[model samples]
Target chain A: MENQVTRVVFYVSDGTAITAEAIGHAVLSQYPVSLTQHILPFVETVERAREIRTRIDEIYARSGRRPLVFYSIVAAEVREQIVASQGFCQDILAALVSPLQEELGVPPQSTLRRTHGLTKHNFERYDARIAAIDYTLAHDDGMSLRQLDQAEAILLGVSRCGKTPTSLYLAMQFGIRAVNYPFIADDMDVLALPPGLRPHHDKLFGLTIDPERLAVIREERRSGSLYASLRQCRLEITEVEALYRRHGIPHLNTTNHSVEEISTKVIEMLGLERRMF
Target chain B: MENQVTRVVFYVSDGTAITAEAIGHAVLSQYPVSLTQHILPFVETVERAREIRTRIDEIYARSGRRPLVFYSIVAAEVREQIVASQGFCQDILAALVSPLQEELGVPPQSTLRRTHGLTKHNFERYDARIAAIDYTLAHDDGMSLRQLDQAEAILLGVSRCGKTPTSLYLAMQFGIRAVNYPFIADDMDVLALPPGLRPHHDKLFGLTIDPERLAVIREERRSGSLYASLRQCRLEITEVEALYRRHGIPHLNTTNHSVEEISTKVIEMLGLERRMF
Candidate 1:
């Protein structure tokens, strides 16, 4: 209940809420502290500053705690004006730097001190959602596993057969964006390749490791479950491979190959056009 | 015993062992899995190939496991020559691309899979270590905490104090090399800052958040220990701030600053040059 207050506020250039949000997300990642962030942009007015302060007050009152309020867009002139205006106190709402230095015990030159400021002031221009989507596409996490439209190719595999990690490796090591789907027992029923996969089947590839290895990995996750049984895993793999064969899906057995090895083999096996460097 | 024996053998170009060790010390990261890479320069002789292969063999034999062996300097012809002369097969050995694909379910692009291959192929001319270090500097764990000499600055703080992530935002946005160092209690006791740090106090910046907020984070991590003790943390912070004030350490209390706010303050406070557009 005490943790429900906002502690940080991110300021950005005019009309850059999304940029501030992205940076806020990035900032939240470093420390494990609990606090919410309020986005205040285009802080050219005392009215906006007072509004932000009021909002902070409401958050504290509702949560029965005064949350840490951060100000990202607090400019020099704005600070001067706010001091004269009602409800804004300059003493409590200092910049974030002094505290961080005191916390880390870093001397003046420790690059750690300048890390965030440099990134925010000097970062790539945040293109709108379209570009963000593109970046995410180029760096897909392989969760949906559904057919990838933008993907030049797709990979189908059994769990722990190394699908998500491999897809990421492909995207990063090379610029070729790849999408992967795990072959769960649920997917075993998905005998027919989804419609989105048909156009890219020639570019599509499948990977399977030994059933014993698959069982070993599954066991690590669930110790004793129908999901981890060797017999079911073997059958699932066998069925998936047959489905791939029936549908003319190019397949590889990744028994001993590392993720890098398989990626190379897929390129060699499928003769797919180079999507990455 | 078994896990210790068969450590992965990764062969790359030079001087990256420090980076490799830093990265490989972890089991698997969000990016590339860091293994004990045996970086080898390109060798032209059959005897050298044999020597390298024998060393690789001993690494595997001692580990009692077939660690993912990644050979980075391999050229197309070099791969062919190594295979032809040393009779290395896929069952035991793997080049960067092929093995990685197998490991990750990624399709390997045969071009520039090796370390030197990456160096040669990268339009950016530098050694493999430098290339990897640069790439990692920007995108390690998809987080940007600039570590190399390239970083222009850093942000330091306690857990949830927003250091690593903020640095990344700056780097990605500004193209500035930013790193973050978490300040531990030991850092305070040392009386002096770490080497390479004393001279850069002019560039040093800090971020501090509210103690109650920090307490919430500590509670999440330790729940019931001295970590969650508000009194103890308050004392630590008071002492740290005293030290900062004693040394004229200019820092910002992130207690009320959003990441953007904190970053902007850093820029203003340190008069740092911006790297991003």
Candidate 2:
């Protein structure tokens, strides 16, 4: 039982459960616990809630410990049923909605799935996101230096050092037009900004990571290659950081950071305004 | 003044300010107030905090109304300065940290920017996300059908029907391997799933949208093409919905939904398990 120490956790929501999962992940990460997650998304009906409660109770009975549930269900009856469950429940939306309603002086519409729905005014934001995604995909890996002028930021990084995912994350999350340019071996040795990136130098932000981390990431892609060697990673990273300093282009090490962290930090460092909601 | 009604809003943080912006966005969306935002990120020093306080006070003096500030500063002294300002403050991180500490029975690590950092356990999730992103990019728009066996979900939709962005969002946010296949004009007319998608029928989820909305979206991309015409959009949507029913495939209309909503709906409809945190 000690070796099989797994706490059953559920992220239950009437809608997508994304909000529940986001807040739950943030909160749960602060604690050092081994969790097994059961995401019961779209738990809109009383029957669904009842079924989820039963599953949670079963887990609790087996483990001899209360299950942890983070929920964002909006329907009153459905919420009540979950409340009656044996598991310890954290009501994510309910906890915020009252304070928000009081602050805003307007009752919520309480419409199902309203949080992630697009309003008339926000359609432009959607369009901007789509545009950013397209821009990011097209301009990925120095694909089109001609459109460097259109990019809000050009990410320069050694291969496998967290550029592509961060670019796509920035594009999708904040509608920031991000383009990533990989620093290849030839480019790294010279320690010069790529000829294509020179005119748009202000938009350049470098991403580097610990060489050991880079080696691990690259080895997963292509094992036994010199490209995945720690020495190669160290040389590339050192040169790229030097290149960034020489060009006065600010940079961050992506060693311990997630894509979300990298994207937000990049935005902060560059003083880039989010193009849309 | 009625037409010029605007509230000054600030998202203040010692790190990226993403959490402040996220909670603030959710809270402020419930109100009808039009906001002019001033994001102050990486406000670490007391001097910077005082400067921000002065700025907030100046905004209050000009508008004759207190500005709204959503802050996630972890440091006590810096948070105090923001609290001392004229702005009406909502302490987002403070609201959660205390509750979380009490619930988890441990004081917070209080480390700046730890919320989005990577842990050793989560590195596998990061690898999964990179794999997903690569898989998505390769299989985008029916580009490759050889690996349909590998996809967690296959999106079927008409052209310009919110497939690409939704796929990218799922991959980045949830590490879900999503591949989107666009239904071409010929395929829509035939009212059939593309041959490439036939083998993966169980994995298919359809995206449809209002014809007028589709027309508006398409018009932005290709102004005078037949594909952008309202008649063409209506024809494609009607046929696609019919095709979804004929195959008993679940579908969602993305007309009023954001990418987040669509991705979640798709995941729910298919009962897809998120591959990572």
Candidate 3:
């Protein structure tokens, strides 16, 4: 809100909004809580499309400063529509993906990753492989923890910092073995990693989000319960973070970040080898 | 390849393998495909836990005596590693998803719905507003489209039989606002769903799949290109089901399906009735 001047990075893709979301999500990471954010929908229809322009002007007029508008797509009409707005700056989405344009792109890549007819077969092999691994792991009698030894990373977080999906994401994208351990009361509250898990500290990566956000997530899973209570969420988060602090564990707060951002941070933190596009 | 075994159904929590892949894949789903399939992962696990063991055991050996394993948290070491030889199984990894249980069955209730703390001035305003709208449609922009207006039931068919992901399966699960579209062409051909795609029918659903299994998808994408060459995949899949025939539209094949699945399918197809949950 400083200078009544807003600097916002909008990710506009000439392709599907999915790409836009990824890029937008990535960009959000570059800035912490300091930046104000607004993500408007796919700019379709002249009316729905024109709203951004007016809003920018309104913001500009109200603040007496130019508004920063990041345009995510490459549609000429969409671009034109966005540009017509007075005092609004337009930033192209794709270009912002990376300095190495060709490197960070998917095909049908130019327009969008044409995701039509993605056969179940293609999905099966990869998915089944993952599920198969999941199956084998699920079936493994804990007599052996050796399989997880080679894991590139392990995620530690209270019950819902999105560790499972993030772990699977790491496995899927980087082909790295990732394991997540939930912070249940028996363990998280006691400020002690489960005895079975304490040995893996060297590979552990912690994920923490705003307790408020955690409460929101819990509410979605089970509303109106002590489990989902914000009061409970705050207490747990504070307890966990304090334990993490005492244990010298480095953690990332996932509030206001996408899974990609969180994963990227984990990869960066773990110094994992980059994933092939 | 086993004696008297023509088909196999694997119930997985992720659902990627059994439904997206096993339903109609190459290495897994082929002429050998037989039997009515049920890949309900935790449903059986929960049922089994609730003394539904007979039901689960029956399902496992249901492939006319060959046995179909309904694996889940049933076998996780988290629960002291229940042991059952020659019956349904489980392991640790798959147990991760058990936390999501209360959200699905018995009428869509999300565990994340009730927690408070997000009531910070900004959080509550936005959260409450979005909570009032359709969760599916409100959570994200509902950015991708498959003829929302004319869509009867969107078919979310990835290549091969990802159709189950988009059509029958989704419809059966959520109940409304379904649409599906297919992606064709491979890494080369520049054709995806035609321009001005006001699907002659109602809302449009989409299907995509894993790329590794999309030899036919490669064919559809490039039609005889080196990548799509049956010689490459060494299978008659391409000739067996042309792209349009399988997915019901000329689409832009996206071999790797990730974001599109979560946002597009979750929002457009399922159309979660309310946002709070």
Candidate 4:
């Protein structure tokens, strides 16, 4: 606080504040300013807004800088109360509501917690995601070979190539039925696909990593192990890439990719539709 | 497509297009119109944007309804090309950029794919998330009681009270080290906390569900068992509530709550900060 000029930022919302935080983080990432953020959720009442306003004022008094407030409060009076505080208050819901009202030819509902609702009508969507999650957890690491047929995409990669996390993310986030099979020592020796995966060639997506990076990742888990050796990593990666090329399996280098990036690339390459939003 | 006027909607971006899709879905949920969605990710080049433009025109020509394009494309020319497409184009990045630039008194770096980059410096963040995921998975269902000390939060609930998914979601989405411990028959008989969880009572959050709903959920897993009986469910839920009250553990009824809602509420109640955005 002494050397760096830190500004207080609040993601204020009447609901979970996910939308506010999403828009706030995206907006704030552009700025080259150090920020300390507070999530003030369930600020539904004017009194609560005023309390937050007073807190912001206190911060402003100490720092001699106006705090930045990003809010998605649906209530007009409550939003106004927060705006009255000493800060640049950006109302995400207000910006969205007007544009949406005009576009939809109707005024927006000023209700709280419109997002993340699971009603009876939307139960199937919830159930589908749960089913996908169950399927992913059950079939992880080629555990259930028979269930491979039901997978939207079967991810094949060496250990620590990020198959498990990516598979779970694909299932949980998008409700995509993803099953991952790790290319172990036995499987990597032969240049042929495993018997279980041979039938699902069209649904297979390969994840490859730099041998150096793979070695480093594995070394973190089990140092001095044969599997974590750079030489072993190089051999396995080379063999896996050759197999991918030989089989015409679409693959992506995941050495520098996040799970989001890997999942997106797999979805794009395979053109897998997201089962749920 | 016939009864409901179907409009083609594209969530377009140079990177994952996740932000575009999230905001698009939130905005479009207000409208009652049925939508046909296409995720045209990695639309980095003007050529790719133009190709998407052609596809939008084709859809518009066939459906006689202008397509909706929600984009987070950072490149000006690429975004312009998408805007020229036959649709009502909404630029999420543009809406965010100008306001943020004005507030911060600095123009944002119009760099493509800024969100999901995995550089050396950012590896710690990724590693933290992976570690949390591993911790959550290992400590799930009290599989390893010795590892309970490592967990940031311990979720205690009756069987099928939405513990596993919530824990996984928290770990994956927020990088929170969450472990769920279910109250089995032996543990529930005595009005005392498990010996393993006694020291970590402060970290425990209880989840209760409607007896009828709990019975239904248990029935789906294993039908006609004593565990799935309504009377048993009522007894268990009653005892769980009494335990929560006696132990002063914060609890939430997850009868009608989605995982998102339940997780959000738990975080709010416990004042748990998300390790990642």
TM-score of each: 0.33, 0.87, 0.39, 0.94
* Cα lDDT tens digits for candidate 1, B1-277: 2332223544322211212222222112211222354434334455666666666667557755444432322245454433433212231112111322332233533333222122223322222222232343444322543344555565555545555435544543334455565656555555344455455566556666667866765675588877577875675566556656766767777654444455555655665654321
lDDT string, candidate 4, B1-277, tens digits: 3564456788998877776677777777666667888987778899999999999999889877778888877788988998888887887745555766666666676554357657777887888898888888888887877777778888989988889888998898788899998888666677578777889877899999899988877888888999999999998999999999999999999877778778788788888886544
> Compared with the true structure, what per-residue lDDT tens digits does model 4 show for residues A59-163?
889988888888776688998989898987887645544565555455544454356666666766787887888889888888887767688989998998999
Cα distance off (Å), candidate 1, residue B35: 31
Which portions of model 4 show Cα errors greater than 4 Å? A1-5, B1-6
Model 2, residue A94: what's the lDDT? Answer: 52
In candidate 2, residue A89 scores what lDDT? 84
Models ranked on TM-score:
4, 2, 3, 1
lDDT of 2 by residue, B1-277 (tens): 2653468889898766665676676666655667899877778888999999999999889878788888877688988999999988877645444565554455666555355657786788778888998899888888888778999999989998999999888888777888998888877646766677888888999999999999999999899999999999999999999989999999999988888888888887888877444
How accurate locally is residue A48 in candidate 2, as Cα lDDT from 0 to 100?
Answer: 88
Ranking by DockQ: 4, 2, 3, 1
Pitting candidate 1 against candidate 3, the one with the higher TM-score is 3
Q: State each model's CA lDDT, in order.
A: 0.48, 0.80, 0.44, 0.81
DockQ of each: 0.02, 0.42, 0.03, 0.53
| Candidate 3 global TM-score | 0.39
Q: TM-score of chain B, candidate 2?
A: 0.88
Report chain A TM-scores, every model: 0.48, 0.87, 0.53, 0.92
Q: Superposing all C-alpha atoms, what RMSD in Å does each candidate have to the true structure?
A: 25.7, 3.5, 21.9, 2.4
**Backbone clashes in model 4, listed as residue pairs:** none
